[model samples]
Target chain A: MCPAMGDVDIDSRTWRLLEPAGLTWRCWDDEYIVFHPWSGMTHYLDAIAGTVFELLLDHDATVRGLAAALANQADTPATDSLNVAVRQVLRRFDEIGLAEPIP
Target chain B: MQLGAVPESALRARFRATGVRLRLAGLCINLRTDVPAVIEQILQLYGGYPLEPGAGTDDARVHLKYASPLRRFIGRRTLVFVDGEPLYRPMLLRHAYLMIDSALDWCVSANVTNLVLHAAVAERGGLAVILPAPSGSGKSTICAALVTRGWRLLSDELAVFRAADGRLQSFALPITLKNESIALIRQWAPDAYISPVFTGTIRGDMAFLRPPTDSVTRAAETAEPALIVSPTYQVGAPLALQPLGKSEAFRLLTASGMNYYTTQRFGFDTVAGLVDSCPAWRLSYGTLEQAVDAIEDLLARVRMDPTASRPAITTT
Candidate 1:
C-alpha cells in the first residue's frame, strides 16, 4: 500500500504542505510532485509510482473496499474490469512516491 | 492560425517563458530558455535539467511551433516558442497565449494521464487546499496572498491528480499573475523575485512567479486529498468555511477543470473521491490582507480540528 502522508488531504492542482520540513507535495499532470527548497529540486512522481503512493495513502482500506468505494461513488458497479484497473493503477502508484507504506 | 502541429524550429521567437518540454502527438520540444530569475524555477519544475543546448542526436526530433492568439488557447496541437525578442508593435492575445499556452503541454501531459484541474495550491505543513475558480476569480490574488503569509506555494494553476491511486500530483511550476495581481504580489513580497511585466497579453501586463525554491527541488513526494476552497474576491467581504457537498465540489471542479473528458473513469472517481473526502469553503474578501488572515483562521480550524466545522454547505 502507498503511504497517504499522514492524515493529510490532496486537492487537484493545489499543493499540500508536508510536516516536519518545508517540502511541498501535490500531483500535477499525472505526475507526483515533491518540491524541496533547500536543494532546489522537484522530484516528479511518475505514473505507476504515484499510483503506488496513492494505494499506501488509502491503505487502511482493502482492495475490495477501494473498488467498492470508487465504483459506488462514481455510479459504476464494481466489476472485474475495475478490479483489474485498480491493481494496474496501484502497481504504478507503488513505483512512484504517490503511494507508500505507512511510516 | 491553424490547429495542426508545426515543427518547433519554425517559430522560435514567441515565448517569454522557459520550460523543459512541450509535447503533443508524439512530437516533443527539446527546447530550453534562460530566466535568470525564473530558470531556477524551470530547473525546479523540471528537476534541474541544464537549459544549455546539448549536441546529442536527440536534438533532431521536430517539435511544433506556435504563435498568435495569446488571450485564449489557440487549439490543442502546436509548438510555442518564446525568447528574449523585441517587438515594435504593442502586444495582445496572441502574445499572451503564446507564453501561457507554451507552458501548457505540462498541463496536457498531466491531464491525459491524470485528472488535471484549474486551481491554485499552497501548502503550510501537512494540509493543502485546492483553490478552483473561473478566470476572473481572485485565485491569483489569493495565491499571492497565501504565499506571502506563510502558505508554501505549490502551483498557481493546474492541480493534477493521480488517476490510479488518487494522490495529489505535484508540478512545481511558477505562479501566474494577471492585472492587479502583479502589483499586489510585488507589494506583499518586496523581496520576492518576479518576472518583468509582459504587456499586451490577453490579461494585460501579466507576470510570472518562480515557485518557492523548496517546492521545485524535492521531486519524490506525494499528498493525500485535503481541503477545497473556492476564493471569490469581494473586497470587504468576510470569511466563511461554507461546506460544499461532494456533488457540488464535483460539479464545480469538473466545470472549472481543464480536461475532465481526457482521463474518463479514473478522472471522475479521483475528482469525486477528492471532493467527498475533504472539506470545502468559499472565501470572499475585499482586501488581500483580510483574505490572508481569514485563510489562516480557517486553516487553524481545519488543522486543529477538522470536525469543528465543515465547508459551508454548497447548494448548486
Candidate 2:
C-alpha cells in the first residue's frame, strides 16, 4: 500500500517538473501561464508558485532548499511558515500533474 | 451587384427557386427560403452585401423553409437546414427570422479557417480593438455605439483571427440589439437602419441593426490587434477602467475562444502573442455615452503610443 501523504516527509523528498521540455509557458509581471502538452491544459501561477516552477525547471530541489532559495530571492529569512507554504504549493503542483516527487 | 440592386421580383424568385448566393466577409453563403418574413428581413438588412458572381460554388448552403402541412397545421412551424441537414427542431413560424440569423452565424462559425472567438471587434485607422465577452455583457451594445461614432465595425459576434499572420479579419455582420439596447441605439443614432423587433423570442425581444455602408464596402480589410477590452455593464455604476494583467487577459481570451482546444498549440501561441503585443483592460460602465467616451480615449492613447498602454511588467 502507498504511504499516507502526511506520513511522507516532504522535506526529505525532492520535487521536479513533469515533462519540462514539452510545457510551453510565458511570464509577464512575475505571473506565469503554462500549457501542458500531454494533458492539453493551461494553468496560471502567481509569483510564489511561478518562482517555484521556474526553479524546478533548472533542477530538482527539496522543500527546504526551495524555501531557502525563495528567501534569498525575496531577501527575507527562510522561516518555517515559508517552508510550509512551499510544501503546500508542491502538493498542489503534484495534484495538477505539473510536478512530481522523487521516491 | 449588391443584393439591394437585384429587382424585388427577381430577388424573391431567386430566393424561392435557386437560392441567392451572398458574399459575406469572404464566404459564399447560398440562402434559400420561401418564408416571406425571413426574405423581407434579409433584403432589408443584407441589402448592402454583395452577391457572388457567375453561379460559383457556396461554402455553406442554408435553407429556411416552412414546415410540412401537417407540422404547420399542428403549430405554424418552420425548419432550418444547413448543407442538406436539419440544424434544429422546427421552430415557430414567427421565429423564422431568428432561425435564419442563427443559421447564418453557424455557417460563419463553422466554415471559417481562422481561430473563431466569441467577441465583438471594431477598428480605427487599421488598429482593431477586440472585446471578448460572453452574451449580455454589453459587448454588442458597445460595438454598435462605437460604429455610430465613426469606428468601423469588424464584427459584433465573432472575431476571426488568422493563425499564420495574427491579423484580425473583418466579419462585418449585423449587430444584434437586445431589449432596451434597441431603443438606446435608435436614440443614439437615429439614421441607422434597424429591423422590426422580434418580441418574446428565446433571447427576449431582439433586433438586428444593419451594418454601416462603409463597413460593408471595406469587408476585405484586416486590422492589426492593438487592444483587448473586456466590458461589463452595470446599471447606476460609474465608469471604471482598469489595466488587466497579461496572464489574466490570456486566460480571458482563451476562455472566450470557440475552438481553442481544437486549435491547441496554435491557439496558445496566437493568444500569447496577442497578450504580448496588445494592451488589455477591464471596463465597466453605466451608460452608453460613458463607455464610448472611455473607449475613444483608450483608442487615442494607443494610437499615440501603443507600447505605453501595456501594463508595466516588474519583477517581484
Candidate 3:
C-alpha cells in the first residue's frame, strides 16, 4: 500500500510514493536533470536524489527501504545518519513535486 | 535570383503591392513598406540574399508603414506590423531599417518553435561558437570583429537551435553596431560597408554593418554548436577566459533562451546535451583586437581536444 507524507502513526516499511506525472528526466555523468512539465521547472539532482527518483519510477518504497537500496547501490552500509539523509531527500522530492505521498 | 537582380522600380512597386519575398536562413520573409529609406537599405544591405519564389507555408510577413496617411506625409514616425497586427511603438522614420530588424526579431522570437537563444553565433572550421548575453554586452561588437576575421556569421543575434538535435540555424543578417562599435569595426575592416549612423533612437546611436558575401551565400547550411561562451566587455581589463561549470552553463542558457519553458523536458534535454557536449566559458576583454586573438586561439584548442579541461587564463 502507498503511504502519505507526515503520517506519524505509520511505520517506515509501510509507506510508498509515486513519481510525478508528465515528468521527463535525463542524466549527465553523475548528475540527473529532470523536467517538470506542469511547473516548467528543471531540477539538477545529485547521486542520492537521482537514485531516489529512479527508484520511485515504477516501484514505491518507504524511507527505510530507499536508504537501504541507496546504500546497496553505492556499496556502503545503511547507517542511522544515512537513513535520516535519505528521509530528508524524500521530503525534498515531495516538496518539489517529483513525488507525492499516496493519499 | 538575388534581390539585386530585380529592377529598382519593380522592387518599390512590389513593396507597395504584392510584398517582396526573400529567403533568410531557415525562414522565408515577406517584407512590405512604402518608406523609401527602408527599401533603399534593404536593396543595399540585402542585395545578395536570394529572392523567394512566393510567400507560402512557414513564411513570416513584416510590414513597416506609417500609422496614418497624413503621418506618411508629415510625421517622422513609423509602425512595425507582424503578420496582421501592429507589434511595436512608432519610431522615427529615419530608423526604418532598424524597424525591419526589430520586426523580424519579434516574429522569430514569438513564433519560431526552435530553442532560440539571445545570442550572437559565428562559425569557423565547421564549428559554431555561441555567445549568449543580455543587451549592451558588446556581443555584436565582438561578433562583427570575428566576421572581419573571416568567421562565417550565423547571426548577429538569436542562436536558433533545433531541440531534436542541437544543430544551429543560420540567419546571416546585417550586424547592428551601436555607438563606438561602428567606428571600431569600420577601422578594423575598412573594406566593410556600413550604413549611415542614425542617432537618437531607443538604442542611442546605431548603424548596420553589411554581412560578408560568403556568409550570405551559405546561409542555407547548418552547423553543430561546439562552444558556448558568455562574454562581457570591461574597459581596461585584460582578456580573461574562465571555465564555467555545466550547471551554471545550463542555467545561463535556459535563462537566455526563448520558448524553453514551453518545450519543457525536451528543452531541458537539448540544453543539458549542449552543456555536456561543449566546454563553456566566460570571457572578459578590454580591446577588440585582443578579444579576437583570444577567441581564435581558444577555438583552435577546442577544435583539437574538445574534452580537455584546463585552468582559466588571464592575459594582458
Error of model 1, residue A60, in angstroms: 36
lDDT of 2 by residue, B1-316 (tens): 8999989999999999989999988899999998898999999999999998738889999999877957656778999999999999998888898989899989988888778888999999999999998899989999999998898999998889987798999999899999988988999899999999999987889999999988999999999999898999888789888888888898888889899877777778889989888888899988989999887777787888877757443211
Give one digit per residue, the lDDT tens place, for model 1 in B12-116. Answer: 232233333433212234444331223333333333212222233232122223333442254422233323232122223224333433444443343345677
Each candidate structure's TM-score, on Cα atoms with residue i matched to residue i, is 0.55, 0.90, 0.85
Q: What i-RMS does every model get? A: 13.2, 1.3, 2.6
What is the lDDT for A75 in model 1? 83
For model 3, how does the per-residue alpha-carbon lDDT over B1-316 read when each residue is reduced to its tens digit? Answer: 9898989998999987878988776677898989888999889888988898855664688988987888877987889888888887887788878889888767656666877778999999889889988888889999999998899999888888876677988878889999988888899999998989989987889999989888999987788888887888888888888887777787788888767877767677788778878878888988889888878887888888877643245343
The weakest ten consecutive residues by lDDT in model 2 chain B span B307-316
Give candidate 3's error at residue B168 in angstroms: 1.0
lDDT of 3 by residue, A1-103 (tens): 2245553422244334444566767665667778887678888888888888788775888777888898998899999887777777777776766665554
* Model 3 CA deviation exceeding 4 Å by range: A1-32, A37-40, A45-89, B54-58, B307-316
Q: How many residue-pair clashes does candidate 2 contain?
A: 0
lDDT by residue for model 1 over A1-103, one digit each (tens)? 3434222221111221123144444664455545434333334455543553454444444445556766775688989776666555544434432332233
**For candidate 2, the TM-score of chain A alone relative to the native chain A:** 0.91
lDDT of each: 0.55, 0.88, 0.81
Docking class of 2: medium
Candidate DockQ scores, in order: 0.02, 0.54, 0.40
